[model samples]
Target: MNYILYAVPFFFALIALELLLDRWRGVSTYRFSDTINSLSAGVLSTTVGLLTKAVGLLTYTLAWQQLALVELSAGSLWVWLLAFVLYDFCYYWNHRLGHERNVLWAAHSVHHQSEDYNLSTALRQTSTGFIFGWIFYLPMAVLGVPPVVFLTVAALNLLYQFWVHTRHIPKLGWFEWLFITPSNHRVHHAQNAVYMDRNYGGVFIVWDRLFGTFQEELDAEPVIFGVTTPLASWNPLWANAQFYVALWRDALRAESWWDKLRIWFMRTGWRPADVAAKYPQSKPDLRQFVKFDVPLSLAQKLYAGVQFSLYVLGGTLLLGMGDKLSPAQMLLGVGWMAVGLYALGVWLENRAHAKRLEVARVLLNLPLTWLAVQLSLLSAGPLLWALLLGYSLVSLAALLWTPRTAVGVPA
Candidate 1:
């Protein structure tokens, strides 16, 4: 039923509501650049998923057809209930291992990179989780959960998680005992020593309770969001690659061959002794930790907001029409999205070169738009081309009007 598609507007609407609720309560839980970066990662993830989701679907279908334990009817309510429970059971392990293992954490860490906890944080996701996440669900396919049932329940499980990413919601008494309430899930996102690697369940909190990974949120200690080793930049592409690059560098520097071979699979933060000694990484002191920010003029902030809104609209269009696209067309869409997002990141970081890069991006849109028409992804009409040209020119005009000193250098 493509439930995720149907929920898109609701997701943004709730985020808007959360913003209003925050203002009413007189607390700020969102930063403009951080929210933009979080949503950019989500946009990149969804756009990339259009290409990679087939891998899991194909693998699940193959396993279900070749090695079914029994023929399970998708129509049965009992079967649906069982699949729902079992999917969360599998998700518990998938999510637990994602935090515990180095390579897996690399793919899963994007969701935790946001320093602020709000509804937009719920939408932040990884672009690369499809690589190994499919294997965790093989048991369902083996139990003969039909692909349709598995897919529907999986979407439901994900949709159920969206609302729990906020700081606006306080703990519910008995509800916290059963499902994953916002309070419990907030602890899961914490980088504090007391809360790290706990509460790995999606919809249900019982998995954590049974598995002994659950920790109650303490009033004495506030949860500090984000990874211990902070993601200080706003780049979506770099956010996905940072951990991998860190591991790769450590692997190359390791003194022993075994260390190099096994580093990727070792416990989440493990590093070779020699590599650790040579490259001492700074872990922030949580008591005095500061959130990453870059100053922007009001015009610059408005310009960024306008550009991001266009990307969001463009992304929604892509998601709706993605099935009709050829691989080449999809790749083209990806390229367009990636470039726009990366440029936005540069602008957010207030890099000295942002102006040059943005100018190039707008100019490049001309050729990219022509290619989109040739690929039949866009209609070949003068008005459409003129609108594209007009957007670029308008953006350029806005850029020129914006103060160059607003964000001097990437902090």
Candidate 2:
């Protein structure tokens, strides 16, 4: 039913409300670049999911048709309740393994990369999770839970998670014990040794409690957010690829084929003895920890905000019509959006060539729009052409008017 897509506006509204609360209380929770980068990862995940979601759906449908122990009726209330509870049970192990195993963490680490935890951070999802995530829910299929029930409960579970990402919410008195709340979820996101791998429940906190993985939020030790291996850049693409690249390089350096093969499945952060000795990695001390940031002029911030808004609008449109579009059209739209996002990341980094890259990106849109029309993905009309021309001209004018001194020094 596309519950996630329909919840987009609601998500942004709460983010806006959170921003307002931050101002009123004089406590800062969101950084501009961090929020944008997190949302960019999320947008990329959704757009890419359009192409990759079929993998999980097809596999689950096949498993259900062939291996179901009994046929379960979706109309039965008990079936829905049972599936809702079971899905979270599956999610607990999937999420726990995602943190415990190297291969899985490579995909799940994107969500933990952000140092600033906010509503935007909730949207910071892993695009590569489709690879192994489908296996977690196969138990439901085997139990004869209908596919419709599985998907609905999955969406509801995810939606239930969005509100728990805020810093403004304090610990709920008794609700903290049985359900996943903002307080416990914050502990889940923390990188401190005490909080590193605890609190993995989705909708229910009971699973963590029963399994002895629960950790209460402590008053003495304040939570420090983010991962041990900091994602030090604002680039979304690099954020997704960073851990995988690290593992790949380590595997290449190992002398033994067994170490190379086992490194991926071993406990998270396990490296070959040779690689560990030659090129060791150390965790930063929490006392001196600093969040990643880049200095930017007012113009740069405004430009980034405006351009990101356009991508958000474009991404929303693509998601809404994704099933209706041809494969060629979908590819072109997704590719163009991805390139634009990459350029935006470069701009946030304030690289010396960022202005030129942005100018080139703005110019390319004219032809891309024409191509979209030619492919019949977009309709041909004078108004469409006029709007495109106006946007390009205005964008070019803004780029030309931006001062050379305003190009921020790369962090």
Candidate 1 — which residues are off by over 4 angstroms?
none
Candidates in order: C-alpha RMSD to true structure = 1.1, 1.3
Q: Which residue pairs collide, candidate 2?
A: none
lDDT of 2 by residue, 1-411 (tens): 799899999999999999999999999999999999999999999998888888888899999999999999999999999999999999999999999999999999999999988999999998899999999999999999988999999999999999999999999999999999999999999999999999999989999999999999999989999999999888888888999999999999999999999999999999999999999999999999999888877788888899999999999999998888888898998898889989999988888888899999998998899888898888855677899889888888988876544445464
- Measured on C-alpha atoms, candidate 1 has an lDDT of 0.93
All candidates: TM-score: 0.98, 0.98
For candidate 2, the per-residue lDDT at 360 reads: 94
Instruction: Give one digit per residue, the lDDT tens place, for model 1 in 327-397.
Output: 99999998889999999999988888998998998899889888988889987658778998899989999
What candidate 2 gets wrong by more than 4 Å, as runs, is 404-411
- lDDT winner: 1
